[model samples]
Target chain A: MADIVLDKVSKSFPDGTVAVRDVDLEIADGEFVILVGPSGCGKSTTLNMIAGLEDISSGELRIDGERVNDRAPRDRDIAMVFQSYALYPNMTVRENMAFPLRLAKLDRATIEQKVAEAAKVLELTPLLDRKPANLSGGQRQRVAMGRAIVRSPKAFLMDEPLSNLDAKLRVQMRTVVSRLQKQLGTTTVYVTHDQTEAMTLGDRVVIMRGGAVQQIGPPQELYDHPANLFVAGFIGSPSMNFLHAAVEEERLRTAVGDVPLGDRLRRELAAEDAPRELILGIRPEHFEDAGLVDEQTRGRGTEFEAPVEIVESMGSDKYVYLTVSGERASAAELEELAADVGADGFGGGAANLVTRLSAESTVAEGENRRLWFNLEKIHLFDPSNGRNLTLHEGRAAGALAS
Target chain B: MAASDTTVAAKWRWGLLDVVVVVFALVPVLWIASLSFKTTGTLTDGNFVPREWTLDNYRTIFSTNQFVRALGNSIGIALIATAVAVVLGTMAAYAVARLDFPGKKALVGVSLLIAMFPQVSLVSPLFEIERSLGLFDTWPGLILPYITFSLPLAIYTLSAFFKQIPWDLEKAAKMDGATSGQAFRRVIAPLAAPGVFTTAILVFIFCWNDFLFAISLTSTERSRTVPVALSFFTGESQFEDPTGAICAAAVVITIPIILFVLFFQRRIVSGLTSGAVKG
Candidate 1:
C-alpha cells in the first residue's frame, strides 16, 4: 500500500558504536523485501529504524513520498510482528486482534467485524474467546499475525516472526506468510538472520555484513553469482567451498588440481589487475560424481580425485565431504563469515571440499573418488580485497564498487 | 502396598508440622479473642479460655462516640494513604524499570535506604513539621506521614514486578497504532495490576498498624486513630480497668487486616507476567 525509502539512514549509539551506517534502500509499493545478515550485522537495527521503534541518527526515511524520520510508530501507520509474538496476555484472541482498531478509535461494530474477518483468515475463529496463554506456539504466532493484518496499516514490518516456531511449523508458516503477503498486497520489510527464509520469501533480498549492504538482488541472482567473498560464503547451504589457487601464467595451481583458466577469466583477471594468489569458489551442486556424468556432459569441466571424508545421504542429493592437501582460503571476510555461524573449524588448513552429487551416485566415505567440477560456474576472488575478479558486467554495482 | 504405607506416613509427617506452625501462629490470636469475650470480673484469671462469655465489651466500645470517630479516621487515613502511595509508586517504578536516565541507580538506592530507615527516628521531626504546617491532629497529618514512609516499599515491590514484564508488548502496542501513553495504559498497566494490588495491600497494612506517628502527631480526638484511641480508653468508674474494652477494640481492628489479606491473596501471585512472552 505504501513505498518506503531509506536514503542514507544511519544509527549510532551514544557511546559511539555505529549500529547501522548509510543504509540506502527503496521498497516499492506492495513489494516484499528482506534484510538478511548474521547476528550483530545491523539488520535488526535497520528494521527498527524503519519501524520507528529506534531513532535514525541521520538521513531520511520516507513513506508514500512523505518524510517520516521524526514520526512516531503509530503516526507512521505501520504494524509490526515481533519475534516473540508479543500478544497481549491479558486479552482474549478477539481482543488481541482488535487492539489496533480499538486504539485507532474505531466504532464497536466495525472493530468486531474487522476482528472476525481477520480471525477467519487466520483460522482462529474458534479461539476468539481464549487467552494467549492457552494457545500453542504456532497458534499464538497466527494471532500475532492476525493483530498486524487486522488494522490494514500502510505497511507491515516483521522481525523474525516465525523464528519461534518448530522447524516443520516454520516452513508451513513461511508459506502462509508468503500467501498472505500476496493476498493483502501490503509492502512488507522482514528482517531475519536466516538466508533460507530470505531466499524463499523475499521478492528481492538485501544481504548485509558489518553494518554495510553487501548486495541487493533477486534470490536466484545472489545464489548464482554472489558479489564478494562474504556473500559467496553466506548465501548457500553447505556453503560454497573456497580453495587457495596460485596464479601460474594462464593456469591456476590449486590443491584439487591445476585449473586451466578460460579466456573470459584470464581477460577479467588482466583487466582487474588480479593478484598472483586468488580464492576459487565452487558451489556444492556444481560438483558431480564424475563417473555418473556422461562423456559429452563431462567435457565442460575438469576432474579431481580425493579421498572422501564423509558422505551424508539427504534423500534428494548426496553431500560428499572430500579432503585435499592445500592451504585453506584465508581472508578477513571469510573468517568473519565463519565466526558468524560459530563454525571455527571452517576453512581450516585441511581444505575440506563439500560437493553435492546425485543421490544415485556410488560415492562413499574413506574412498578416493573422481569429482568433476563445472568450469563455467566457478568464481575467482582477489585475495587482498575479497572482490570477485571474474564478476560479470550488468550485476548490481553497489556491492562490486564497494 | 509398601508405597501406599510410605505415602500415608509422609502425609502424617507433613500434617504434624503444619499443625505445629498453625498452633504457634494462632494461639495468641485465640487468647486475645478469649480475653475480649471474658467478663470484667474474670479479666485477671490468667486463663487461655474465658470462664464466661459476654458481649458487653463489644457493646461498650460501639456505644462510645470516641471509638467510632477514631475508627472512622483510621479507615479514611489508611485508604487515602494507600491509594496515593500506590499511584505515585507505580509511575516512579515504571520509569525506574523501563527508562534510562541519569541518577536511575541513585534513585533506586536512595529509595531503598529510606525503606530501611527507622520510622521512630523520623516521627519527632515529622510531628514538628506537621504542627508548623498546620496539618497536625488532622487526617492529612496522619495520611501524609504514612505515604512518605510506605512509598519506598511500594516502589520497590512494583518495580521488581515491572522488570519481569516483556518490553516487547509495549513496542507491539505502539506498532499496533497506539501512542506511548495508550500502550502503557492498555498493555503494561493491566500486566502490572497484580503487583500494584500487592503493593497497595502492604502499604495499607503499614499505615493501619502505625502507632508512633498516630500517637505523636495527634493531640485530640478529632484526628486520633484507633491504636492511639485504644490507650485513651477508660472504664465506667475511676478505679476500674479497661482491658476488656481494649481487647475488643484490638479484635475489631485485626478483622479488617485479615479480610484484606484474604481478599487480595490471589492477586499477590507472581506468574501473571508469564505467557505474555515466550518461556
Candidate 2:
C-alpha cells in the first residue's frame, strides 16, 4: 500500500462540463479519507478518477508517488465498492466476493479459502450461496465490502455505498465501515454526499464543491474550524447558522442584541483590519436553555432568547430552527459567512438558525418562539471571505454530544 | 377508516369491470379454438359444440402424407430460424449495444429498416439469389431466407435487451479480469438469456406462420416447409372441400406454436416490458 496523491486534478466530460477542477489531495498510506459534497458536486467523480473508472481530464494521479494516469483499475490495484453495490446480480454472494480472486486466477482451494474468510468477516457465511437479489441492502453493502477486502488492494474506493440503505441501516453500517477500515488498514477513499457519513467515517474528510476540494482535515477539524463558509455549512447537519453582526469597540452587536467580543476573536482581528461587518456562525448544538444570560456570559459563554420557528423531535435531541431578531439568513449567505470571516451584511428578514438541544429540553413550537444560544460556543466569521476569526479549541473537541 | 375502506372496495369493483373489458377482446381466439375442435358436420351445422364427438377427422389428417410432412417442415424451419436468429442476433445486439466501433449506429438502424421491409419485396430477389447459388429446394436456402427475415426483429429486440444490462456488470467483469469479449460472453450473454429466449420464440412464431415466403420460394416437397405443404394439402383445381383436413392441419400446426408460446409467453411478456420500461 502507498499514498494516493492527486496533484491539481480536474475532470471535464466530453459534453464540455467540468465535473471536478484543479483538485489537490494526498492520502497517506492506510489512511481513511472521505470526499464529501452536495449532490452532483463531483466528489464521486474524483473517487472514480482515482479508481480509474473515469479517465482524468487533467492532472497527475500517483499511487506510491508513481503516476498511474493510464493504468486500468486492476493494474492500479484499487478495489471499488459502487453506490449501487454493483454486485453481480446473477452471481452468488460467495462468487461475488471471490470474483476478483477468480480473475486473479488463484487456485480453487485458495479461492474458496479467501471467499470463506471474506464471508466470515462480513457475516455473510449463510448468504454465500444466495444471489444479490436475495440480500438486504445492508447485507449487500457488507458483501460489497467483502469483495474489496478479498482483493487486499493498495486502496479501496467506495462511491456512496450507504446511500441505498435505510436510515437506521446506514447508521449501523457506518460503525461497521469504520471498524472494517481500521481492521484492514488499507488506504481508503470513500465518497458520500451525506455530511454525517463524511464526519463519522473519515479520519480526514475532504469537503468538495463543484468538482473542487474546498478543504481537507480531520472530521472535527473541518466541522469546528471550517476554512470557508461552504465547508462550514456543508460539513454539519442542519448546517451552521450565519448571522450578520457588526464589530464596535471590542463588542459585536446584532439585530437580536449585543455581545462582547472575547479575547480569541479580538486577537485574531488584532493584526488585521477590524471590518465594520462580520458574519457569525453557530453550530446546531451550540445553543441551550438560558440558565445564565448576560453580556459577560455572551462574551465567552452566555445565552440569549431567539424565537423558534420550527421544532423537529429526533429521539435523542430536538432540532429547533430559530429566527434571530427576525433577520432572514439565506443558506448561501450563511455558507458564505462561514467561509469568509468579517463578511458584509447578510441581514434580511428573519434569520434561519438551527439549534440542537436535548430531547428533554421542551422548547415547544407555537408555544413560544423564543430560545437561547450559548455565545461562548458561537462561531465568528468574516463577512467578506467567510473565514473564521476565532480558532477556539472547543471547536475541535469532538462531535456535538447531542 | 370505514369510509376509506369503502372507497378502496369500490375501486376494486371498478378494477373488476376493467378485467371484464379485457376478456371481451379475447373472445375471438376462444371462438377459433372451439371451431377447431368441432367435426366438419357440426361446423357446417353451425353448432358451437359437436353433439357427436369423433376423433376420426383428427385421425384422418394425422395419418396423411402432406399434413405430417408439413408439420415436420414448419417445426424444423421455425427451430432453425429461431436458433440462428437468437445466436447471431444476440451477438449483433451486444455489439450494437456495447461497442463503440464506427458506423455501429448506422448498422443498427439499417438492421431495423431491414426488419420493417415487407417480406414479399425481397422474396423474388432472394429466390433468384438462391437459384444462382443452387440453394433453392434445399434446407440452407430456407434457413438463409428465414434468417434474413427474422434478423431485424431479433437484433432490434435483443439489442434493447442488451441495453437494459447495467454497464457495471460488464465493468465488474472487466475488474474480474475478463476482456471485453469475455465480459460479453460470460456476463452479458447469461444475463440476457431471458430476453434472447423471448426474441427467439417470437421470431420462431413469425417464421412458422409465414406462408407467402415458404410457398413462393420453395418449388417442391424436397425443400417445401409447412405452409407450402399445408397449402398443397388444399389440392389444385379440384376445389376439394377437405374442410375437415384443413381444420385438422390447422389444429396440428397451431399446437406447437401454442406449446412454444406457453413455454415462453411469460418470458416474452417480461422481457418485452423490461426492454420498454426502465427506472
Candidate 3:
C-alpha cells in the first residue's frame, strides 16, 4: 500500500469549465479516502486525474512519493472499478481478474494462482469461468473490486461502483466493500455522490461543492460539527434543519414566540456571533416530545405553537414536518424557519421539508396541531457567510446555544 | 399519465409504419431476384413473372473468361482490402478512442477528412500517386486505394464503439500488470470483435462495388474486378445474350456479397445503430 497525494492540483477543460480547483489532499497510506459530492462537483474528475485517465491540467500527483504526472495509467499502478463494473463481458471472471497479471507478462501458473486467491476473497470461486453477463449485479460489483485488488496495486480507485445496483444490493455490497477495504487495507480513493456511502465507507471523507473542496475530515467530524452550511446540508441523512432567527434583547426572537436563553447558551452564542442575525441549525434527532401530559420538560423548553404538516414513520424514528404561522422566511432560511413553524404551514417551501422530528416526540400530520422545539440543541450560523457560529475548540467542544 | 399514454399510442402507430416500410423496401430486391431467372425476351415483358425459365444465363456466365477472371479479382481485392482496413482501422480507432497522444486531434481530423470526401473526387490524384509508385494496375494499387478511402469510415464508426467500452476495463487490465497495448489486445479487442467485424463488412462492400477506381486503375483481365467484367455482357462483338444469361451472370456475381452480408449482417446493423444513436 502507498500514500497518494494530490499537490495543489487543478483541472480546467478546454471549454473553460474548471472541473477541480486547487485541490490539495494527502491520502494516508492504507487509508480509504472517499471523494463525495453531488454531480458536477468534480469528485470523479479528481479520482480520474489521479488514475491518469484524465490529464492533470496543473500540479503534481505522487504515489508513494514518486511523481506520476507523466506516467501512463498502466505505469501508474492503480486499479479502478467503474459504475458499470466494466467486466470484459466476453471474458470469464478468471480471465477478467487475471487480465492485468497477464499484461504484466507473469507466468500462466502465477496468474492462475492470483486469480484463484482473488476469487476466493470475492466469493467468486464458483464464478471463475462465468462471463460478466452471467453474474448478477452484486457479483459483478465484487469482480470489479476484485479486479482492482487482485494485483495489490499501490492504490484502488472506485467510481460509483455500486451505483447501478438496487437499494438492498447497494447496502449489501456497501458492507462488502467496507469489509474488503479493511481486510486488504489498500490505499483507496473512491468517488460517489451518495452521502451514506461516504459516511459509512471512508476513513476520511472529502466533501466537495462546485468543483471546490468545501471540507475534509472524518465523517462524524463533518456530521457533528460541519465547517459550513454546505457541508452540514450535504453530509447527513435527511440533512440538518436551518431556521433564520435573531437575538433581540438577550431573547431568541422569531415570529412564533420569544424563548428565554440560559446564561450558558447566551454566553456560547455571544462568542459565536459578533453580529445580530444568525442562522439556526438543528438535526432532527435532537428534538424531544413534550407531550401535553408531561410537566418536567413541557413549556420548560422553547415552546412554539406549530401544526404538524406531515409525519414519516421509520420504525425506530419518526420525521415530523411543522409549519409556523405568519413567519415569511427568506428562501435561503426557509428550511430552518419551517422546522419551528406549526405543522399546518411548514412544508410548502421544501420537498424534504425544514425539520425532521424524531420518533417519541415527532408529531404526526394533522395529529399535533402545535409543536415544540428544544432550545439547547439549537445551532446558529452567520446568514451572510453560512459559517456556523461557534468557537470549535475541537469535535468535543459543543456549540453554545444563544 | 394521460400524456404518457399518447406517447405510447404514437409509438404503436410508428411500429405499424415500420411494417409498411419493410414491404416497400423489399419490392426492388424481389423484382431483381425474379429477373435473374428470366430469359432476355421475357425480361423486358410488361408482366412481373417470366413466361419461360432457363439456366442458359448461368451456363453463359460460367463459360465466359471475362466473368470468371473478374470474379477471382474481386474476391482477392475485397479480402485484401478488408484485412488491411480492419487491422489498420481497429488499431487507429482504439488509439483515437482511448490513448492520449500529442497529435490525437490531428489524427481524428485526418480520419474525418478521408471519410467526408466523395471517393470519385480523389480518383485522378490517387491514380497519379499509384502510377508514380509503380503500383498501377496491380492488386496493391486497388488495395491501396481501397484502404485510403475505407480507413476513415471504419475508424469513425469503430471509435464510437470504443468510447462505449468502459475505460475502467483497460485500467483494470493495467492494474493486473499489463501494458497499454496488451490491455487493448486482450480486453478491448475481444470486446470490439463485433465492431471490427462490422467495419470489415462495410469496407468489403464498398471496395467490391467500386466501379470508377477498378475501371480506371486496372487495364487488363488480370486485375479487373467482376463489375468491370460484367460490363462485357453488353456483347461488343455480337448481339447481347437474352435475359437468362445476364441474370445468371448477375446472380453469380452477387453470391459472395450476399454471403458476406448474411454472415456479418447482425453485427453490422447493431454497429451502425449504436454508432448513429449514440452520436
Can you give the TM-score per candidate against the true fold?
0.94, 0.78, 0.80
> Model 2 clash tally?
36
Full candidate order by lDDT, most accurate first: 1, 3, 2
Better of 1 and 2 by TM-score: 1
For model 1, what is the alpha-carbon lDDT of residue B160?
A: 89
User: Candidate 1's error at A114, in angstroms?
Assistant: 2.0
Candidates arranged by DockQ, highest first: 1, 3, 2
What's model 2's lDDT at A235? 75
Say which candidate scores most in TM-score.
1
Candidate 2, TM-score of its B chain: 0.84
lDDT per residue as tens, model 1, A1-402: 899999999999999999998999999999999999999999999999999999999999999999999999989999999999999999999999998898889999999999999999999999999999999999999999999999898999999998988999999999999999999999999999999999999999999987889999989999887888889888999899999999887788998788887666665556655688999999999899998889987877889999999999999999999999988999998888888889876455679899999999998888999999877778888878888766767352211122
In angstroms, the error of model 3 at B170 is 3.5
lDDT of 1: 0.90
Candidate 3 chain A lDDT trough over 10 residues, lowest sum: A333-342
Highest DockQ model number? 1
